[model samples]
Target chain A: MIEILDTAPLSSVQDLGRAPYLRYGVSYSGVMDRLALRAGNAMLGNAEGLACIEIQAFPCRIRFRAARDFALTGADCAATLDGVPLPPWWAKPAREGAELTIGAPRRGSRAYLAVAGGIDVPSVLGSRSTQFRGSFGGHEGRWLKAGDVLPVGAAADAAVQAPGFGAEPPQTAFPADWAPPDLQPSTTAVRVLPAGEYGLFMEESQQRFWDTAWKITGQSNRAGFRLAGQPLEFAQRIEMRSHGIVPGVVQVPPSGEPIIQLSDAHTAGGYPKIGTVIEADLWRLAQAPLGSRLRFIPVTYRDALDALRQGDAWVAALRRLAEQYRSLCNSGRTP
Target chain B: MTAEEIAQIATWLRAAGLDTLELTSPQTRLRLKLGAVAPVKELAVQPAAAVPSSLDARATGLFLPIHPWCETPLVQPGQRMEAGEVAAFLRIGPLLQPVTAPSDGIVGRCLATPGKLVGFGTKLFEFSPEGKAP
Candidate 1:
């Protein structure tokens, strides 16, 4: 177990985000930085949905009661293990009594820390995700605290650790079909699906949405993302009916600005949903550092489904590659 | 279209995974959404759009459009304040305290019940202007 000596606001337990529970009044609680979580877990050779630490605005200080191996990813928080600088997106081992300190983010908003066996929190409603609004997840559904002695768990197969930072991240057209270009964090474009309430707005407002860049205001959280952009409006004929919504659903309240729902959004809402973002690009939305400028390019539903399917296939390929790597490591074929 | 046809369309748009739907009938216009908020997911969506939504008041507090959270209400068709003023306020005990209007607006609808939770961002009053809704 680990101890959280001190922590500030906006930190919580995040897995692959709780799901199929929104209908029960529970928000989809999970890591704000989804890709980072996956990368960390992949380093640990754990299951895909393993729980990980989600760091927000400020970094956290921790003293590992029983340090083993861990990895950091997402948000590029300049991390230092026991005062020695550690690389991001790579795994390393630490002995007991070592202090691991992660500083403020150098790039993204949230950073993910994943260990081998995952955080040992009592799962609620079948998830270890901390639903902050409801206050229940890891460490009593709050941030970890000092003197919190974590229990010991089995180390990952150890042999499965990637040879170096140059290994591939498993199945994808990203490897063979294209130029076999490496999958690095390269582009910054965000995509959206022109689904739902897009038609209600006047043509001018729709044009404005795609024609300009929107700045993300600091007034954002798991609940919703308040954006700063052109105050678009309609001919004054919208009714507020409470309804079910999902993450990435852009809602236009009376303020004329749009509030994009995120992982910790409310299950029901009263605003008009302009559109939903594609799942693949939601990672980019999640990874956006503060004050980052972003734009929306709406795609058709078929395109949205294609993106979803592509994401699913990619994750499946990663899982299979992880299993193969484990087998290879165990068989002494490569170590 | 008739109200029956409009309501039926609401059912279909919802089936199509649509969150916002508008139905303009010869007698009435309806805007509805299926809200998925928590702690109080009760029909935030107008259960019946053809009929007027009730602004049931829990207490005798003066009606204010301010949600206590700083977001101003967007004036739209068939729109009514059920609750919440999302107005940004001074750093108070609450995150964004809902600012209430000093002078009460017209109490177009209210059902008195005191000592309730006084839900955050609930529309406690309905203001009526002398001029008709545009």
Candidate 2:
């Protein structure tokens, strides 16, 4: 068990996300950066889709009720356990009564904290992901707050008796050498595919959209990212009935400002979609810090598929390495 | 015992992957411990007093006194630190791993050159117990 001493707003439990409910008007609310969630769980030898705490704002503090192993991934939040500093994207064992504090991130926006057995929240609608809009999933259907206690699931036998017991040293670090090249934060160019209404925009507007760097406005949230740039004008003013939509659809409203749908976006919309961000590049946008500039790069359908394949290959390699390391740790032979 | 005997024992302890070793005889008793990787040839006969110990690098990375941008080092030569207190940091890219003191002691010397890449098991600092030599 873990007790939340303090937390930022919107911090909640999330897994891979709920699916097959878009027809029922429910958005797939999971982690903002799915790769981070998977990486954290992989470090702990937990299932890739296991639920973990998604922390957004910083200075979040939690106290362990029992000895457990945990891993922090995604953003560098300057995490410290019982006053001892921890490296980002690393996993370590925490002793009972140890206080872990996460400070403001140095890079990226959100971080995921994954325990050995995952957070024990009752699954709702096929996922433990929190749908903040509907308030129906995750811990009490809301964000974690002070005094909230989260139960941990049963850990693997090897995880319970690993070497170092509950001790954490800086040497016991996992190298993320297998992360995909595209997953690195050095690039801000996101790949997009032309949607049905791509040709409806004026020639100048289309040119500006490709050439200009768009800044993510402060009004963005889990629902969608509101981009700040030149208002895009349409070649013709056209109206259409409400239609089904999914995350990654770049919808241009009457204000001419484009809004890219995200994990918790509405299931249906009526605005014109100029383009759709490729599924493989959504994680990049998810990790993009607030106010960061982003450029849209058009890619062919085959290119998007190739990017996804690369991501899967990286995850597979990571899984193999993590399993090998876990077994070595269990046998007291980890270097 | 001679310095050659002590050096041989230190080499043996390191080769065996053991941290400490102690042997007692009717005439003289000896204890040998391994710390940082320095010139073992220097481990010669000396006055029987508290010897300086060192904390070695746990991982290979760029050594930082505190953080990459922080001007202040985490510990000074004469500064005293409790067991488990962070004495330095090893930065690998953006990640910073804490280098902790092995025991309660007063820092004697910093062997590691700051802002340089250090290898695993490289001695970073030397310290003596509080009651020992400063």
Candidate 3:
């Protein structure tokens, strides 16, 4: 078992996220950087979709209630185990009464820490994610603070066997192959699909859509990204009704800032959507921070769906690889 | 739409091949008797009610303040206009005048504000019809 000892900005349990709940006004409350989530989970041979600890920003601190194996990846936050350096990726053993400390990011923006059995938390709406807005999942739908102890789903010793490794420490979290994506990637020229109110803009207005650079403002979060840049224009004044919003939906507010909704964004919106970021690049949106420049590149609908299909195949394959690794280690007999 | 039904609309729309739909406050019930048969085109309810006031600048220019500092804007939604009602001072040029709204309405809800540096044909402002002031 494990729990929070000290925390920084935010840390919560997340998985692939609660999808297909948008129409009900439910946002997808999942990990911010899923690739990192999968990588860390894979490292520990855990089941797919198990809740992992998502550390956003830093100074995250935690302690174990029992001994277990876990993997950490994503943001470049420096981590230490009781004043000694620890790795951010490989599976490491944690004993009862151990304190794991994480510091501010040096490169990446978000990070994931996966344990073998994953975090033990009540599942809400088919997920263990902590949707703060709804107060549904996670250690009570809130950020962890100092002195918080999280319960872990420690596997029974009979059912668990740690993978054997040579008695040697790894090079470090700075391995070129395992580094997290850019800590704060620029958003210059974001690609988008014309959406609601897309035609409302005059031809030139549409042209201006991609002509200028927009800076991501501080008013950004998992729900959506707010941008500050050249005010976008339309042809005439007409107010249509509010409509549904999806991941990648870019809503232009009265402030002229274009807000691109993310995986955790609300299902519906009143703002006009000038464009949408294609699904393929939606993951990249999670890595950007304030002041990132952005522009939109358009693509055909067929291409968009095809891209989604491709991403689905890739994630599905990744899931198989994880299970296969677990089977290999657990079963003495192999095909 | 009960909070539960508001959740299923996405699947219903995708299965039906429609891209847009709007609903009013009462629709929150999503009673099949009143919802399924409701006109698909009538989905738009109080779209602007959700947004706040904003200024979608269409062009870029310098903003020169004419009047002295007055805390809040004086113009009301239905208030009559006299071609620049609150005149203080003025200037427009090489400056990137963040085109602000002349009248109050949903902020940033507009795709474009009246005059910034919009190309030949860009949307300018989207506002509610001017009604008689109370």
Q: Could you tell which candidate, 1 or 2, scores higher by TM-score? A: 2
Model 1: per-residue Cα lDDT over A17-108, one tens digit each: 77888898889988776766776676567776778778785668766777566766666566777786554454556667777788887655
After best superposition, candidate 1 residue B48: deviation in angstroms? 85
Tens-digit lDDT string for candidate 2 (B1-134):
55644664464356336676555433445565678453333234445543337777755567877543235677888888987677777654333456777668887688988889876568898877666665
Q: Which one wins on lDDT?
A: 2
- Residue A193 of model 3 has an lDDT of 74
Tell me each candidate's TM-score: 0.63, 0.71, 0.60
Report the C-alpha displacement of residue A80, candidate 3, in angstroms.
3.2
Question: Per-residue lDDT for A127-168 in model 3, tens only?
Answer: 888888888888778766766666767452222223211101
Candidate 3 or 1, higher TM-score: 1
Candidate 3 lDDT tens digits, B1-134: 23333334443344334544553342231322223565334344433343212222221121222111223333333334332122111112111112233443332223433222332113333333233222
Candidate 1 lDDT by residue in tens digits, B1-134: 34444444444345345676543333444565667422423233434433222233221122333222123432222343332321112111111112222222222433322223332124443444323342
TM-score for the second chain in candidate 2? 0.58
**Candidate 3's error at A8, in angstroms?**
2.4
**Winner of 2 and 3 under lDDT:** 2
Please name the candidate that would achieve the greatest TM-score relative to the true structure: 2
The C-alpha local distance difference test score for the whole of candidate 1 amounts to: 0.58
Stretches of model 1 off by over 4 angstroms after superposition:
A150-188, A319-335, B1-134
**DockQ each:** 0.01, 0.05, 0.01
